[model samples]
Target chain A: MILPEKTIERLSKYRRVLINLNFQQKDYIYSHELANLIHITPEQVRRDMMLIGHSGTLRRGYEVKQLIEKINSIIDGNTVQYVTLVGVGNLGRAMLNYLKNKNKYLQIIACFDNDQDKINKMCCGIPCYSINEAEEQIKKLNINIAILTVPTNVANEVADILIKAGIKGLLNFTTMPLKVPSNVYLEEYDMITSLEKVAYFTQFIE
Target chain B: MILPEKTIERLSKYRRVLINLNFQQKDYIYSHELANLIHITPEQVRRDMMLIGHSGTLRRGYEVKQLIEKINSIIDGNTVQYVTLVGVGNLGRAMLNYLKNKNKYLQIIACFDNDQDKINKMCCGIPCYSINEAEEQIKKLNINIAILTVPTNVANEVADILIKAGIKGLLNFTTMPLKVPSNVYLEEYDMITSLEKVAYFTQFIE
Candidate 1:
């Protein structure tokens, strides 16, 4: 069975909750109870589990240990993949800080910036290098994922450099859409579009 | 005709592109061209327009002036709402700065923080008040929409406060599921959950 894109996202979240519960040594859980934590129907949880090929008991929603193992196996807990940030702006820096302390599964190994003052320095113990050193540093650091935090005007340009440097996945934060090779994957996060949608949704509140 | 939820979001984005084109005084945009700008299919743009019932000429695609007029009319331009911020953390402050000066449609009229040093100071000319004064400030400012950026530990508690203050719509950034009334709409923007989902999707990349 194949999981849908949106369902995989929910699976990651469900895994997170299960991980927390596992730490607390909480054994039994009901679909209705898990649904209450996630603000969704218990039936929806069961349906999502089916996408990932997990079967649950009637009274109990899912086995916490078994569910965590299933989700982890599906989520890919193999070799650690290192990621690099391309820009050092406000949003980029915030992401840099977040990636450093959070996400034990992922590591932000290096950062690239054109700013001379920001170069040759360490932010939260991660090295920052000139954009010219990208290819060299990527090989040196074994970084596979590139987080594009550069400005819109240069997003595609930097993306080309990252792709050429052999980055497999790109997490793009710029408003500009990068023209990438079909082999490389792109995920964009545009705050403007998200907030505007929030503003629009506010209009329909009953 | 009432706009679908997704269509409303696209229309909000379309408005921005139209504003850009209007500044350049360009007339007659093609659906394909708008699709490129907004990163959607031409068929999607047409379907969105159909949802709004704002008919545009096939040759013209959608007239910039005419489209703006229809959108504004449907969106109720007279009463632009104010959005309140409940936390003064990095994410909350970043949201304030991100939303500030991006668009003039909605304003961050007030911000709340429990820290004494952060309270009463002007953040981008919008005053920050104490969390204790949240209900009073919400009523005084007549704000209906709120963007909750508090830590996950206190997200539910703060949401209860905002709901009590007559907040109709909430854009929650915490990972926790809130138990608000059916009338109060909630949307979560948890970065940890989002990034984990990204990690899950990373496997699908060829």
Candidate 2:
């Protein structure tokens, strides 16, 4: 069953928190505690858990490891998903540094750039290929999801190339809102817009 | 008047696009054209414009420069909003790089970090101060909003310091979800959650 987009985002967050709790040797977490950590209502957490067909006992709450495994099974399925990065700029390298070796099921296998010096090198241990070779490299590496960190002027151009290369999902880092095919899933992480939103809210704080 | 959060985000986007169009010597934009550029429905764009109390002619559409000025007056008011960036690491540096000289109204005037090497230096032309100096520097700089790019382990600790120093809003980039006081506005930009969300959607793409 498909979950709402907001629900999917929250599940990913829940899994992150659960993995951390598991690392601390914590076995179970109450919906209230989890909700508090994520800054959401306890009722929202319970509803999400119910949506995923998980229930918690009043005594033990929810099993942390079991919930993580369930989320992994649902979100990631069985095999690892090969992903790619489309730019090797400072932002791109920062993303690679943060993402590399972080997840078992989602892996950034390759990166592409138009810069000659960066091409054919390893950025944060992932291979960097020339943008000219993106279509072939993406197909050969079986990459479906891509992280786009290119300049705004070339963002749509690069996105077009990625879509043409059969990329099904994109995480866009540029401020330019992109247009994609209906089948292609796009997530725009515009720092400027986010910053401005914060700026707007600051005015209300007395 | 306080606009919806989503509407504020869209206004910021419209302003960005309009600024570009104005720079290109374009004077007016129809709702459909603006919506197409931003990947939104024309009705939604028109509705937002209406909410902002702006109108356009059928023949000329909305005047680009006038709408931008109106958005600026509403979103930013008269004074520039000073912002502080904590954690001068890769992500922090990248943010400074992107935001410097980008906007006249929103300025990242300072950055804070625990690293001695990073402190007491200029990062992307902004002053880098020690975490020990966060409270003083923030207050002295009149910073009301902070962009947090610190490690997950210390995210909450640093957030407390920022809030205590009188920050009214926070844009969090760490993977750990943060809990802030009710008066504080928090925006979490979790790359892991976003990546995983894209990963989930990729499964449905044929």
Candidate 3:
């Protein structure tokens, strides 16, 4: 089943909500209640839930455990992805430290950057390589995913190199757009635009 | 004109691309070439450009200056947002220390954490506050946006208090989903998901 882009985005939010419920020892949840928690219409919650192949019984609502497993299966939790972080700047390095043993399902295996002083080193046990050695290292270590936090100027250049080295997807931290093949999945994150949205929407007529 | 969610996301990317181009002293850009750089169809880029009311001549493409002004206008460049980074963890504090401040558009107003020793202190002129005083201080300062880098466990509770105190948006760093009112916008970022996408598309299936 092909979920829409919007649906996939919501799955993470739903998964987080379920995790919170699990922590709270809540066993079941209803569409309306979950919707209220997420600030969406109850009908919308039901629709999102339906896409994951589960729903609440009128009285029983959605079983928290069952729903989590269902979402997990759809979300492919079994695979622990071998990931790499490039750039190792403040944002990239922070990401490197954050990913250190954070998730059981995905792990950062290596770090690469152009900074000569930081090159040929290790960040949190993940080896760091200079950009000159990136392709060789990525290919040698069999890294499939890359988190790009390089400056916007070099985003595409790094991405193209990664793609050439057989990277499957890119998580872009720079505010630049990347040119990748259709086979490649890309997610662009801009921290500034997010701050800007809050600023503009403060007294938004809409 | 209401663009698709996908397009709105792309605009941020385009603005970043244009900024980099401007920095490189590039004067003009063609839609096709720009599309080629970003891995999108020229037609799609042209359509998005149209949404911003920007026009580029056939060979000349779009005037870089003209396009940038239009983008800034559409994105509302009038208000400079002041962001509060809650929790001076690796992610939060690094962002405070590293992100370029010359722009002065999105300013880090203050930072808060649970540590007592760091309270009422300043990191780069931004005050640090105790978590106990967060709600009151947030309200007192009239902070409109918050960057949450606290632990996943306390993410929800902190965000709940923030929403109640009239926070309009959140740049969440924790791996938790925050339940907020409909009027509030929460951008949930998962570093692991960024890696998983690269793995699933690149290798797991094969």
Candidate 4:
């Protein structure tokens, strides 16, 4: 069954919190406790767990490891997903550094940039190719997902190139509104909008 | 009136889209058009507009300039908000570059880092200070919001210091779950979870 976008986002958050709990050696967690960690309501947590066909007794709560395995099967399955990063600027570099070996399922296999000096160089052990080579290299590497960090002016053009090159998913960091085919998936991560949201809430907090 | 967090986020997105429309010299936009640009339902856009006490006629839709003014009043008032960054690492630096002069109401006034070599230097025209001087500078500068981009291990400790230093809002970039006082507002921006969400949708897209 297809889940709502909001539900998928919450499931991802729950999985992260569960992994952290496992690392902390916490084997069991109540819905309310997990909700508190992620700043959501207990009922919301319970509803999400139910949607995924998982349940816990009111007394025992959830098993962290088992919940994680269930979520992994739903979100990632058995195969690992290979991702590529476009635009090796500051944001791109930061993402590469932060995500290096961080996840076993999702890995950034290669990167693309327009800078002549950066092309053919290795960033965080991931090969960097020129934007001109993005299409050829993406196909050769069998990359399915792309993280777009290009400037706003070039975002749409770069998105077009990636989509045409058979990119199934795009995690957009640029502010531009990109038009992709219905078959392609797009997720925009706008930092300024996010910060402004925080600012709005901070002012009206009761 | 206390608006829901989701409403605030949508408001932020609407404001951004309006700004882009204004840039394109578009005076009026229908809710459906705005929703199409942002990938949301028209009803959601109309609901957000209603929450902000703004409405449009069926003929002209919403006046782009008037809607922008209304949102500005709701999200940001007459005075600009002063923000500071806590880490000058790759993520922080990229954010600084992306946000420089982007918003007139919100400005990143200063930055803090523990790196001795980075202290006393300038990044994007913003002065960098040692983490030890964070409290002193934050208090003196009247900085209420902080962007925490430090490593996971040090995120909590630095957050504690910032909260004790009188920071009312935090835009956390680290992966660790931080516990702040009830009075303090916190927004966590985890890129990995966001990427995973994209991955999930890309795999399940029907």
Candidate 5:
């Protein structure tokens, strides 16, 4: 069953925390204990577990390994999901380095840029191809998700190209808003807006 | 009047779009036109404007310049808000470069890191001080907001120092969860969760 976007994100977080708990040799975790780790309410955690059709014993609570496996199956499915990055600029390079080997199921297999210098070079061990080769590379590599870090002027242009090349999901980091087809799942992340929101909230905090 | 966090973020987005519209010589915009630009519903835009106590004329729609001025006052007070970055890693440097001179009212004045080799260096024209000097620098800079990009192991350790140094707001980029006092505004942005959410939704789109 398809879950809400927010629930999926929380499940991913829960899996990350549970992995750490499992590493620490913790066998099981109460809903409140897990909730405290991620700063979510116990009621919310229980609701998510219920939505995922998982139940825990009153004595031992939810099994850490079992919960993680359930979330993994829900979010990632079976095969590894291949991703590509478009635009090898500062943000793109930073993302490439940070996400190089971070995920087990999700991998950034390649990157594309219009810069002559960046093309044909390796960034964080991922080969950078010219924008001209993006379609061929995407199709050859079976890449469905793309992380877009191109300039604002060329963001939509690059997005259109990526979508036409069979990209089903896009994570946009450009300052400008992009208009994509309804079939494409788009996630827009704006650092400026995030910073501004933090700044705005600080006033009420004090 | 205080606005909800989501509304504040949308206000920031609307201002960005409005500034672009102002640059294009557009003077008036209806709620629907503004909503279309940001992919939000027209009613939501109208409600946000109403919350901020702004009105539009039926004949000409909302005056772009007036709305921008009103939003500016609501989001940002008269004085500029100073910000600091912790951990001058790849993500931090990219943020500094991308944010330098980008916002008139918000400025990232300084950054802190524990690496002695990077200490006392200028990154993107902002000074990189030793993390040991974070408290002094934060107090001297009158910084109320901080962007945390430190390693996951040391994120909370550094956050504690930053809190003691007078930072009222935090934007955490670490994978680990942070626990802050209620008076401290914290925004956690986990890129892994964001990417996973996009990947999960892509399956349903097709």
Candidate 6:
């Protein structure tokens, strides 16, 4: 069953919240309680839960562990997905360090960079290869997804290479608006845009 | 004018694209051309421009420079907004380096960290202070905005302090769900959720 993009996003968020609950040894969670934790309405939470075909009893609410498994099955296919990181610049390196081994299923196996000095070096124990070797390394490692942190000038050019190398999805960090093939999924983490959003809203307060 | 959130986001995107066009020595741009660059519908672009009280001519479209100035006037208030970065960890340091002087309107003037060793040291020429001094420093510097890059466990605690420090807005990078007062604007940059979205979409490709 194909789910809407918004639903998928919420499912991921729900899984995170459930994991935290599980860590705290919480066995069950009411829809409204979970909604409050994530700052969403109870109706939206119920709607998302229904989309995953999981219904909670009125008394027991949602079984934390079981709900996590259900959401994982829908989103992660219950398997580990290997990802690659391109560009080991400041932002890229920061992401590499922060994301290392954080998730059980989603792992960044290798990284690619154009800097000859960084090539053949390991960043946070992940092997760094030259951009020239990105295609070969991706295929060898079976990498289908990539996080792009290169500069804006070379973002699209490098994206072209990644797409041609058979990457199925991209998490873009550069400011450039990348044009990927329709078959490839693209998610942008535009920091400037987000910061500006905060700036725009803060103006109304004062 | 109380523009919608989505329109504000689009306006930020439009400003970036227009800046790039201006850098390339292009003066005017049609709505369709701008939409194509940002991968949005021409109608959406037109609607956003209308919200900001700007319009394009039939022949010359919109003057790129004028549009940028108009958007900046609305979003940035034609003056610089001072911001602070909390937690000078790897992510915080990278953000400090990446955002330093990138915008004339937005500046990260001070940073806060709990580490006593890092306090009183200069990072990227910005002074680092102990987390205990955040509130006083925030008021002293007249900073109303902050970027929270602290660990997940301490995210909410630090955020609470920031809110109490009179921070009007925050760009949250931690995975933890933060609870702030209604008057405090919060924007979360959840990288894990974003990566999972890519992972979910990549499943359908194969």
TM-score for each of the candidates: 0.88, 0.96, 0.81, 0.84, 0.94, 0.95
Q: Which CAPRI quality tier does the interface of model 3 achieve?
A: acceptable
User: CA shift at B3, candidate 3, in angstroms?
Assistant: 8.4
Query: Which model scores highest in DockQ?
Result: 2
TM-scores of chain A across the candidates, in order, are: 0.89, 0.95, 0.87, 0.92, 0.95, 0.96
Q: Give me candidate 1's TM-score against the actual structure.
A: 0.88
Report chain B TM per candidate.
Answer: 0.90, 0.95, 0.86, 0.93, 0.95, 0.96
The CA lDDT of each predicted structure is: 0.76, 0.89, 0.72, 0.85, 0.88, 0.88
| Per-candidate DockQ vs. reference | 0.44, 0.73, 0.42, 0.47, 0.66, 0.70
Model 5 C-alpha lDDT per residue in residues B37-84, reported as the tens digit of each score: 888899999999889899999888899888888888888865698999
Off by over 4 Å in 1: A19-23, A53-61, A177-179, B18-25, B53-61, B65-78
Q: Candidate 2, A116: how far from true, in Å?
A: 0.9
Question: Of models 3 and 5, which has the larger lDDT?
Answer: 5
The collision pairs in model 2 are none
Tell me how far the alpha carbon of residue B31 in candidate 3 is from the true structure, in angstroms, after superposition.
Answer: 3.9
Could you give the DockQ of candidate 4? 0.47
Evaluate residue A55 in candidate 2 and report its C-alpha lDDT on the 0 to 100 scale: 88
Candidate numbers, best DockQ first, in rank order:
2, 6, 5, 4, 1, 3
Docking class of 5: medium
Angstrom error of the Cα, residue A33, model 6: value is: 2.5
- DockQ (0 to 1) for model 6: 0.70
Between 1 and 3, whose TM-score is larger?
1
Lowest summed lDDT across 10 adjacent residues in model 4 chain B is found at B15-24
> For each predicted model, how many residue pairs clash, with residues at least 3 apart or on different chains?
0, 0, 2, 0, 0, 0
User: Of 2 and 5, which scores higher on DockQ?
Assistant: 2
Model 2: per-residue Cα lDDT at residue A201: 84
Q: Please, what are the lDDT tens digits per residue for candidate 4 over residues A19-105?
A: 754533776789999889777899999999999999887787998888888888888875798899999888788888877676678
Ranking by TM-score: 2, 6, 5, 1, 4, 3
lDDT of model 3 at residue A5?
Answer: 59
